[model samples]
Target chain A: MTTFQELRLDGVRRRFGGKDALTGLSLTIRRGEFIALLGPSGCGKSTALNCLAGLLPLTDGSIWQDGSRLDTLPPERRGFGMVFQSYALFPHLSVRKNISFGLQMRRLPRDEVRRRTDEAIKLVRLEEHARKLPGQLSGGQQQRVAIARAVVLEPSLVLMDEPLSNLDAKLRLEMRTEIRRLHQSLGLTTVYVTHDQEEALSLADRLVVLRDGRVEQIGTPEELHNRPANAHVADFMGYRNLLPMKVKAVHGDTVALDGSGLTLEGTPVGPVAPGDDVVAGIRPEDLRAGPHGVPVTVEVVEYQGRELAIEARTAEGVALFLRATERPSPGDRITVTADPSRVLVFP
Target chain B: MTATLPDRDTSSTRVARRHRLAERGIDRQLLLLAPALICVLALFVYPFAYGIGLSFQPAEGGVFGAYRAFFTDAYQRDTIATTLGLALPAAILNVAASVPIAYRMRGRFRGKRVLTTILVVPITLGTVLTAEGLLNYLGPTGWFNRTLMTIGLTDEPVRLTNNYWGVFFSLVITGFPFAFLLILSYLSGIDPTLDRAAATLGAGWWQRFHRITLPLLAPGLATTFCLTFVLAFSVFPSAVLVGDPAGTTRVISIAAYHAAYEVYDYPLGSAIAVIMGLVELAVVAVVLGLRSLLYTGSTGGKG
Candidate 1:
């Protein structure tokens, strides 16, 4: 077993012309940790990775690997492995040669090179197509070859940028499982970047969600999914129901909200002034259909295999979605209830 | 009953007429190729066939007798050897001179367009004017020698005009731009991304050029070689003007011109021209066939 090593970025900033790509972003990656940098497109996730890989010059920052300064090192000298979003495999080389390229660069002994190539090809289960070029392989197979090439060098930290985006749906799921297994087995510090929430939640030990070149939230998947830091994080993590509520009164642990006859419960996660307008968010699954629920008219009913997505509008014209088994069709009046603890209040 | 049976036979005859109409449509399509075929026959094929026939025409004054006599002569044999000697060196020098200059000019800098224009001016002047300029500049009592003598670099004027070097200089000045343009385009056409990739993969500048750039440029180099060689081999005016037509610079094209224009032996001239064309075709074929080894088989499709 190998000991875990740490990677840290100190004030990393990247700028193109006048626009900032990564603005003073800094994070620490633990040894043997699988961290997912999750965000929407153009959220500076890829730019951060490129900066970490030393592919781009940082406008201001320093990168330290196990306490060694790495900001000035060239990409090949940085001692980090990167699998690109497109899996930028050297098209001219065969799968086996691609895996052996770094080793050859190191000028290793011939016998060791052959041994490592075989081991890498076996790890990716690409022995059968070892002699074939990447173009001849399927997208998933090319991804495996890319992973194999990155892993063959056995660098301390591995950075993957949307490696599974090119794969088909079924193959993506399969490779997701494979990647998780490899991460567990290899115990390498990894930073995986993706725009897909499910990909981040399913594969990451901890998630770092970014927005507008800033870190929105950083936590475990459960922490992000359950207690999002803000409305943006909640909306990004699949919280579709956001309603404006006026706080009527605050008493001890409970707060009364306006425009509703019933009192709403929340964790008071953010600062909220009494009688002030605020936003309350709840996951669709947290709301239920019951007799004492809030009155709303159903706009649409969508059956999504295991559950139903009910689009409903309140008497005050507030739109919301509630997940439940029994969904009311369009034009049907329904009442939706939410457990007060499941609701999130933000100012 | 008799009228109904006759109607059925009439319908079958109409079907046969339609089939004939379809056949005529196909005939017109085939006929559309006739004009192109006739042009190729009259313009290209007829001249080539006539040249071969004239080269092989029998004895006395015509046929292969002139070719046989020409080849059998010692002076003609020496001329062919001398032409090859000058042409090959000039071609090689022309290609060599272009590679570095074009390589340097591949990237943009101040005065690049001006330099390229100045370099291309000699090509626009063609071989004859270039040869005249070379004669004026390189003559024994020309500006070059006079300056050197004035500068005390040489006590006597150097013999630069009416020699093999004068013809070679003319060829280089005129042919360099063609080779340079061909190679500059070739070098620029290679995706710069490939260089970046190589660099990211731990390849240094020279290694990237050698391993990636050189292999990709093999086809361009081969083409440049053949084109420059053909141009140099066909040196006629320069060989007659700036060169020693009696001694050193009597090339094969000069031999053909002498046969056709001076001696008024059109058959001999045609035979020599046919030989030159055949030699060029053979060289080009060899060059192309050899380049197959370095070709990575068209980087576009999945190999």
Candidate 2:
């Protein structure tokens, strides 16, 4: 096990032209942890990954990997494996040659190279295509070959940049499970970057969500999904039902909200003074159909196989999506409620 | 609603239309090739068949007399040896000199545009002008001789112009740009990702170039060599302008021209031209065989 001393970023700054891509951002990554840098496009998640991989030079920062300074090292010298989004396979080489390339570079013996090449091919389940060129394989197969090539070196940290975005849905699911299993088997530290929230939720052991080139929040998947620190985190993690409210009264274990006629029973997320404007965040799946639900006019009802997602507009003109068993048609007057414990109040 | 297929009569008419369309496409293709096909048939095929016929027949009359003289004389056999000797080495030298310049120019820099222009500018200069430039620069009593004299390196001018070396130099200079451009484009067209992947796999620059770049560029090199070889083998203008006519640069084409124009013997000239074509075909076949050995499984000459 490698001990990571905070993987500190001391005022990391990157700029392109006048706009700051990574603006003096600071974050720490624990060793052996699979951290997904989650953000929208152009939020500098990829820029941050490139800096960590030593593929991009930082304008001003110090990055130390396992107590050794990494700023001076080039990508090849960094001793970390990188899997690009494009897979970047050698088109001229057969699958076996591609996997054995790194070992050959080490000037290993012929027998050893052959053994490791077989092992890497087996790891990706591409033994049958060992003699075929990369161009002959499908996109998913090519990506697996890329992973096999990266892992054959046994680097301590593996960096992946939206590696599954190119794959079809079914293949994406298969690769996600495969990547998680491979990560566990090897016990290698991984930094994955993706804009897809479900991908981050399903694959990452911890999520480092970024916004405008700064760390918005960092926690386990459960912490960020259930109790987001702010509006942006909540919205990013699929909290589509956000309503504005004022803190009318605050007491232990329960808070009274003004306007929209709602009282949420939960501990305040952070320090919230009285009369502070706050937004109540709730996942659509948490709301239910009940007698004491807020009166709303159903606008559209979409059946998503297992659950019915109903969009309703309240009398106050605020729209909210309620997931329920009972399907309501458009223009139907209804009431939707949620367990107060699941509601998140953020200022 | 009842499911129905298209009417059979309509479908049959559509199929007939498609058949007619395909026939029209074939006709169009034939039409597109007609001009080149007719030219090759008239000028190339007829002449080649006639040469074979003429070469086999016994020399009886004036034009056939030269053919009879060529086969029976040992002195005429020496021309074949001299032609191959000069052409093969000159072709090899041209190809060898183009590789490094092309490799260096693969990447971009400030003076890259200027350097490329300078390199390609030589191609536009005709063989006559190049020979003239060689005469001015490399001739005895020219700048080269004056420089050697001023440096106190030589007591007299050195002989370079009006020689085989002058012809070879002119060939290399004029032939190099064509080969270089071919090679440079091929080198640059190699997906750079291959090298990046190699680097990530722990291979250094030399290893990557050796294992990947050179092997992939082999087909391109073959094509460039074939083109330059044909050009060198058929050399006539530069040989006449810059080279010694006294048995030095009497390449096959020059011999054919001399027989036809100066010696006023058309049948002998045609015979020599036929021999030159045969020699060229043989050389090209050998070069292609060598190319196949280097790039064993590739399709030839994609460009």
Candidate 3:
């Protein structure tokens, strides 16, 4: 089967006064795919989403959908559903009316509007509160109403901007699964913007990591988690242990590092030359107490329910993190080892 | 002190002390409010009660005689219709006209401050000043008619002053800015994100305004219209300056003035004043009741 590109953003740029919020950002989205724009605040994730939704005009570049121009269209003519961070529910309207708003705008038959509204209300499981105003519902319930309102339109694409950020931790988790389930069942193309890496990692089929108004990396969760393209990507992927080292030697696909009386070898994710300064990254979970690598002394041991995180320092005073199922006491000496394939070297 | 203590006596004394402190606090609060209370009673309440009493005196024939005469006399009764005819349309037109202006001016732009200052000038010009300006501006030889004639829009200078339209135009000019300012505040208070969301949901500009903005502003619009109507209804100086006081524009206020000052009929004047207050109250109640029927409590999210 051949996949068709449903949406294409070509070199989209947005400038605010003298500053560039998004600079030549480009992406292609396929049909029925869930994509996440993940970055910290001011990284231009929301700007990119608004540009696609036609809420903000791009300074340059054209957006095409199915080979036709979309950038020139007005936001209302785009026929895309968007859920804002605040839910943006009409407080004066009942849940049913809110969900049926788009259908009414389309001038659908009254009966059909009613039926579809009922179906959407049931989809979000908000039938009991269908007649209640947004103010009467809880935060989670209001979000469900927003989703129903968006989905009832059966739009070609849905854009969500930090929709789960306002919810509590537990609700965020539940809604993450709920969103994934909705995407699967409806098979709707979606573009979600969020600052939470975990949310992007867990909810998205493919995560696009953005930094400073640029795309850092784009890949599946496991791929990006196991193999980040650079030190910044690795750091964002929960690789807490970063060490500055000098490159001792470069083998065809791998590089050897020497720093702080420690020598190690790892695959070079980026270009590196012998005698070049580089940053080495490793996840704490990948480092274990074994007999093959660096020797260090345990300084602090933190008890996480499923695993223990041991903070240690090497003889050369380099910081390291080791995860073990059993707790280790402070002042205990141990050798921590990491697989060379799991290590990342960036020049 | 080794002596047995009576808990009831001590508790009662403690309670009494707290009661005295609370009384002192309330007394201080009342003392602070005394000046405002005295002013209201002396300036508003006393005058209002005195007028009501005067309206019911025997000089006007009997307790209900003046009211009956007001309703029975053809000329006096016609004033109610004439006043409402002018005031209602003027108030409605002011509110309707201000909606779009206020809506367009809600967002910021280059000349927004200048435009706002210009729009607010009419409000600062009180009714008397506004009436005087209208007489000069809308008279047969004034610039308005001169321009119309020069442009060949009319062969003759239009009869704009000393008529019903003269007073009507004056009311609109003065009442519009007040209405616009009120509607603008209401429009700004609404969350703009709601309209954005509506737009993304496939609502066009008119649909968004009609379905979302208008419904939310209904209460505010109704209130503004009621207040503007009251302002237009109590027309005295403007009616005299721009209207044919002896003929077409003898509104209730002019009638009350004539009865009290010209004819020395204080009871009849007070009766008309009492009637005006009752009519204004009735209109306000009806408008507010209709507003409640249209929309419930505020729709804006937890302020």
Candidate 4:
């Protein structure tokens, strides 16, 4: 039986043909924790996950599981379950055989293999389709078989690389909950990699946002969404409006943006003094029409059922978007404001 | 029904128009295919029909006379076994040898293209030339044996050419590349992710091969064997040049050749040709029937 309390990645780096795919990635995964490596394409999130699974060799540094070196082991010896973006289920094998693959590989007793495989099938709710080939099953069913195939081995950690990316929107939502439930019920530590921030935010206990092969920030979904480390994270976190502003004054936690017809207040993130240039980030949901605020002309309004997503331009010709219940026509002047906490001022 | 006269008229005209369009399309396609169809009829079908007819109308006792006489005579009947003994081993060895080499070379590596190109050079140089080249290099007292004796690996020159072993070696040299190419194409069709998935599931290289790669490739291997067998079964030029045609390596094709060309016994030769085809067909059918027992799963290239 394999068990581990924690897995440590000490400055793990992967180089591909002289180009660094992952650079100095350091992370500690505690037992039963679901960590997400979230990034756009080519940001090394997949590389980090592959490194953990021992799929890709590390060009620099090492991975340790409970004080023993794990990097030296082959992928088969690592004893980690990895669900590829493609699922990678064997096309030739039946669902039951695919699930029992690891057990058979370990040379386990036949009855024990059958018992574990059946239990895994039950866990994934695929008992009816266990005899079917992967090609014979639906896409959602195939995804479940892939999950069942990996989790049947009872690996200490499960790595999922965009497992739901191929599914339709409804199926994706359903599998998201299913994956979380499995992780919790099985007590399996998970490291999920996805470019979708919403998936990472909802599924992971903590999100590690990577950029250009480096870890940009690592925090909980709420923390990263509300309090981003920089402009890049802020943009990714759905703070759609990032207006360049000059800091007129810094009073306590809030800094006032210079020359708004009505003075706009935003909380400062990095160090700032008088007359310093900074970006003011405002989430579309946070910016609301108030009695007194920055005056702008409504340019385009997209009716989104309950709320109207209004696109407006400020007096200085800077474009901004905000949601409002009030229906506004084009060329109508409106005032929008955010609370000091909602408005993030980044240097 | 008479009240809906215009609607029925329009529907009937539409059906007629559709039929006319289909007929026109088919006619044009048939016209374009005339040349190739004529070539096949003249070259393949006509000769095949003629041979079957000539084989039956033997200058002998009855309609079954040629077949009966060929089977009754020990010398003529033994040729089938001789042919199978040579062809089966050559085909099996070629395909078996190519499997590991093709599997290993499936992935890209330095000098891979150069090596494959060099290996396939024998195929481009046809069977007779390859046999001639083997006769030069691998014959008794040839440079190969000279080197072996000089190095004291063997005292006497190894007898390779002018025997059954010579023809077998020539067949392998000429036929290996054909089998390798076919096997390589089959191996390439399998998704690489399946291998990775197997590895992650705790399968070592050998386990992964026998269980995963071999099963997926079984159907393709069966096909490669049948094609290679057919080619080797009809061994003619190489058996004469590198093998003892009248002695140990008296293949069926050599007997058929002597009957048809040398002795002017066309009916006997035609009967032998038909028998040769029947034997090949029997082997192929047996192989295909056995191949069905393997897991002939889709390679999932679409996925």
Q: What share of the true interface contacts does each candidate keep?
A: 0.12, 0.42, 0.78, 0.76
DockQ (Cα-based) for each candidate: 0.25, 0.28, 0.62, 0.70
Global lDDT scores for all candidate models: 0.81, 0.80, 0.88, 0.91
lDDT by residue for model 3 over A192-256, one digit each (tens)? 99998889999898888888888898898988888888888888898888888999998888788
lDDT of candidate 2 over A1-347, digit per residue (tens): 22354466667777766787886767667667788999999999998888877766888878876577877776666667778888877766788987888888887899988898899899999989999988789999999998999888887678898999999999999999999999999877789999999999999999989888888888999999888889899999998878888887788766766555444444467777679888888889987767885778889899999999988887877888888788878998887777767777787
The 10 consecutive residues of candidate 3 chain A with the worst lDDT sum are A1-10
What does candidate 4's lDDT look like per residue over B171-249, in tens digits? 9998999999999889988888888888888999999998888889999999999999999999999999999998889
Q: Pick the candidate with the highest lDDT.
A: 4
In candidate 4, how many clashes are counted? 0
lDDT of 1 by residue, B250-281 (tens): 88888888888898877788888887787778
Interface RMSD of every candidate? 3.2, 4.3, 1.4, 1.1
- By TM-score, the better pick of 1 and 2 is 2
DockQ head-to-head 1 vs 2, winner: 2
Candidate 3 iRMSD, 1 decimal: 1.4
lDDT of 2: 0.80
B1-303 per-residue lDDT for model 3 (tens digits): 335467777888998987898877744466888899999999999999999998888474679887777778888878888888888999999999999999998776889888988998998888888888888898998999999999999999899889999999999989899999898888887778888899998898999999998898899899999999999899888899999888899898998888789988888888888888888888889999999877655655333
Best by DockQ: 4
TM-score (C-alpha) between model 4 and the true structure: 0.94
Off by over 4 Å in 4: A258-263, A315-318, B1-27
Worst 10 residues of 2 chain B by lDDT: B294-303
Candidate 1 ranges beyond 4 A from true positions? A1-4, A241-269, A274-281, A287-302, A310-322, B1-42, B58-201, B216-251, B298-303
Candidate 1 docking quality: incorrect, acceptable, medium or high: acceptable
